[model samples]
Target: MKKSIVIFGSTGNLTYKKLLPAIDNLIRQKRLKKDDRVYLLARHDISLKQYIEDAKKQVKEMLDWTVLEEVLEFVYFHLNQIEDYQKLNHRLKDSGYTDNVFYLALPPKLFPEVAKGISASGLVTKGDASKRIVFEKPFGENLESARTINRELWRYFDESQIYRIDHYLGKEMIQNILVVRFANRIFGQTWNHNTIRNIVIIAKETEGVMSRGNYYDKIGALKDMLQSHLLQMAALIGMTRPKTFQSEDIKDAKVKVLNDLKLDSSSVVFGQYNGYLDENKIADDSQTETFIFAKAHFMNDKWRGTPIYFITGKKLDEKRSEIIINFKDDTNLNQIFSNAKPNNTKLVFKVAPEDGVKFQLNVKQPGLSDEIISGHLDYCHTCNWVGNTTEAYEKLLFDVLNNNKTLFTRWDEIEVMWEIISEIQHMNIPLHVYDDFDHLKEIILTEKGVDIDAL
Candidate 1:
């Protein structure tokens, strides 16, 4: 059966740069069937031929002309209007594709209206289970808005027919969180709070909000990163072992962690960059945070007393995303020295700029007195082999096409995350304003007494 994909905001940044390229790459790699129909729907006035050419250029000069032409032949476009939802039903039927997947790339606020329109327009057949919808995140501004959107979606589609996308969940390393924890007994045995001291997840970017200031000002770092991406990672880290690697089982484990999460108000810190107000379209009085640092804890027996630090910032020192697990130091190190310094072992999942793992171990200094120092055992995924790694969108799009919900976010997960974030928003935590990366690090060191430079 052919799948018809309708991208709602076809001309948006996400569609052009990420979605189109991902689809093209998937077709090129033969991960996607060449004949599956794709409908590009947006308000743009461009012709279908013109849009196809434009999308081709954005996909770069890949040498898969056979598959590319086949994909292009199945492509169509429509100028979206209020009534286009009704027209879409006819369009899909006329194209002989009873099954359709709608990808909403528009602003989060437009979700409710669009969902209602699709439902009212009879886009979904009464007996057809093949209709699916994919939603991009910042699912809602807060808990209430999220619930409202979920309610509207529920009116039209079953939970199984809706796919909530979080690109981070599609990353190869992020997916490997399961394998890293369950497949390796060394790490799995010590995964509890009994051996693990603290876990820190950091997503630091060197670039600031350039043209996205409007969206950034409204969503900020809490809703943008901490509320969604970091929380998802925490769930994977803290959850108990799933019975199977299936999507529902993985999600069940993740939901367990989300349900058990307990936020420490004193452990939360929000910050905004100094010149954030100077960004284009940003208001001078905007109090939105571009940086966030919080300590999240799971209330279960496996993770009690373990603080999961969630940190993210834009316009920082460098671009990096990492999960650092600091294990408890050996208490019997006094045998080496009466006052031996504690060097706790760290297991790091370096997610970006490099996709790899690093184990920081304390070893005796070579050729000297019995002194110890930290050493790194690193594994670089892209160091030697292969062409480019699969983009997050590519993996996510593949999952959607194949009806594999393993990498997609569940509504229950999103609801609980927003609930946690809404509580933090009302907690009255002050947003620390800083000039640059160094200043931000200084503040973190002073307030939290944790060394940012070391991590």
Candidate 2:
């Protein structure tokens, strides 16, 4: 069976930085066989030779030269005017391919237009023949908008044919959260709120939105990071173990977990960097939030009373995405050591800048006296196997090619996510202005008791 990938907005940032490089990697790894064809669809008229030259300039440093050469041979350029589906269908049919995957790497506003064009053109694969469409998030600004988009997409594509990608789901450590919770006996035993006191999820960047102020100012950190990525991570870590690793089973658990999230006025915190107003294209009076710190709790018995803190922002002190699981400190040792109670065992899953796992434990120091000190059992994926860990886009793209939606977001999940966001938006929370990441941390700790000190 021959498959063709038609990528709209092929010259955009995502296509240049991630999509093409991932395709090149797939070819090098022999996952994307040579028989498959890649069509770069755009609104403008660009020669295939010129397009290839531009692509080469962007990805040459990251991709091997030979891999790029072989991958380029399978690539084709098309002047795709998605409004006319008949010509689009004719163009695809002429390419001599049946199975199709339409990847829209364009702005959210263009999704409906392209989808309608695909549907009206009737240029897709027939029943039971593999045809899929991939979309990136801001699934919609709010719940109502998300529902509308889902409805529009459903008109043309079946639920099975739609792929809503959340790249964070493809992170090595994010994928490992399930294994750590369900596969390991020790972690599995203490997975519930009874043993675990709380969980902290953090995604931070040191650089501000200097170049992307126009986009960042509109969406802010709440919608850009917390609503999709942080929420997804919290659901994965907090959800009950699925019946199996199958896509449906895992997705079912995630949806249920999200449905159990309780949001209130008191639990939400929003912030904007001090200089965010001064950024180009940003309004001085804009109330957009570049930082968010919220405490969310699960309504289910398995996670009752356990607070899951969500924190993320641009222009922070550090650049990292990690999950910190703090277990309840042991009281049994309080009688023996008097002042030295058993330390809280923390499980850390580092998701960015590197992939790794760290277990914080209390151990007796090497001395005549009984001095307890913190010890660590850590495994750094990048350190041990440098340049071997798969990029999030690489894993995600391969999953789309293989028609595996396990790491992808579903429509139902997106709807629930937007509902949660809408509730917070209606609360009219103030966006606190912070001078730096440390000041933001101080405010969080002082007000919410969320100690974001380095783990």
Candidate 3:
């Protein structure tokens, strides 16, 4: 079957940098057939030639323009205009393209209008999963808003046909979490409250909001990072093994973990960067958080009483995203060797800047006077296969093409996620100001008693 991808906001950064490049990659991989069409819809009145030229300049990779030109079609779209969608429908039909995938790369506010226009214009038949809609994140401002968005989307498209994308879920390491946990006997056996001391999820950025100052100031790190990416990573790390690896089962497990998450006002720490106030489009007295460190725990039996820490920030540290699982230090070693202080065994999953796994074990030091030291079994996933690894967007776009919802978030998971965020928001946690990463780390240790080194 020939596939047609109708991308709204096609001239946006995401479309040029991610979506189009992903489509180009799919074509290169022979995953997208020759007949596959990419319909670029934008509010701007730009010709196909001009759009292609702009794309060539912005897209980082050397694109096969011949292939892209063959598949590409630019349509002048007015987002709220019903007549425009009707014309778009006609264009698709006239070009003999069906089995459409609508990628809405627009702002969250425009989702409902675009969804309504698509449905009303007869672009998609009711209850047809083949005609899917993809939604970008900042799903909604809060729980109530998320509910409203979900309700509005459900009015036009069935739950199965809606793909709510959280790009973090598409990363190779994130996908590998399932295999690392469920497939490995060693990790699987000890992945519980008994063996694990605490789990730390950290996503740090060295750069502040660049061009997205307006958007970042409004959403903040808590909503932008914790609510979606960090929480989703936590679910993947903490969720019980699913009955099957199917989309529904995987989502069910994730939803269960999300539902069990507990956060309090006292457990949350919000921080704004030193110069965030001076950022373009930011308010002088903006209370928005550039950093968030929250101590959370699961209420379920498997992970009950286990401390799970989520820490994310901008302009404070080197760019890194990782999950660290610290196992309980061996207490019995002290009884055998009076001078022994065994380091806690650690399993680290490095997510960004690099993709890798590191397991730290206490081993006897050489020239042993009965000395113990930490030995690492590190596997650099990216180092082994440098350029061959699939980009997150590429993997996600391919999944959309294949109608695989395994990597995409389910509505129920989003609901539970918002509920967690809402709980934190209602707590009225005071936002602090931090000078740098070291200061932020100090604040966390002082307030929450969570040592960054230990994590």
TM-score of each: 0.92, 0.92, 0.96
Q: Model 2 scores what on Cα lDDT?
A: 0.80
Output the lDDT of residue 320, model 3: 92
For 171-202, candidate 1 gives per-residue lDDT tens digits of 87898888988999887678899899888999
* Candidate with best lDDT: 3
Q: Which ten residues in a row have the lowest lDDT in candidate 3?
A: 335-344
- Whole-model lDDT per candidate: 0.81, 0.80, 0.88
Candidate 2 Cα errors over 4 Å, as ranges:
56-61, 64-84, 125-129, 339-343, 385-387
Q: Which stretches of candidate 3 lie over 4 Å from their true place?
A: 338-341
- Assess candidate 2 and give its TM-score to the true structure: 0.92
* Position 323, candidate 2: lDDT: 94
Clashing residue pairs, backbone N/CA/C < 3 A, model 2 = none
| Ranking of candidates on TM-score, top first | 3, 2, 1
Question: Candidate 3, residues 223-303: lDDT per residue as tens digits?
Answer: 899999999999999999898999899999999988999875587889988888998999988999899998889988999
The C-alpha RMSD of each candidate to the native structure, in angstroms, is 2.6, 2.6, 1.6
By lDDT, the better pick of 2 and 3 is 3
Error of 2 at 44 (Å): 2.4
TM-score-wise, the better of 2 and 3 is: 3
Off by over 4 Å in 1: 52-82, 337-341, 368-370, 384-388, 453-455
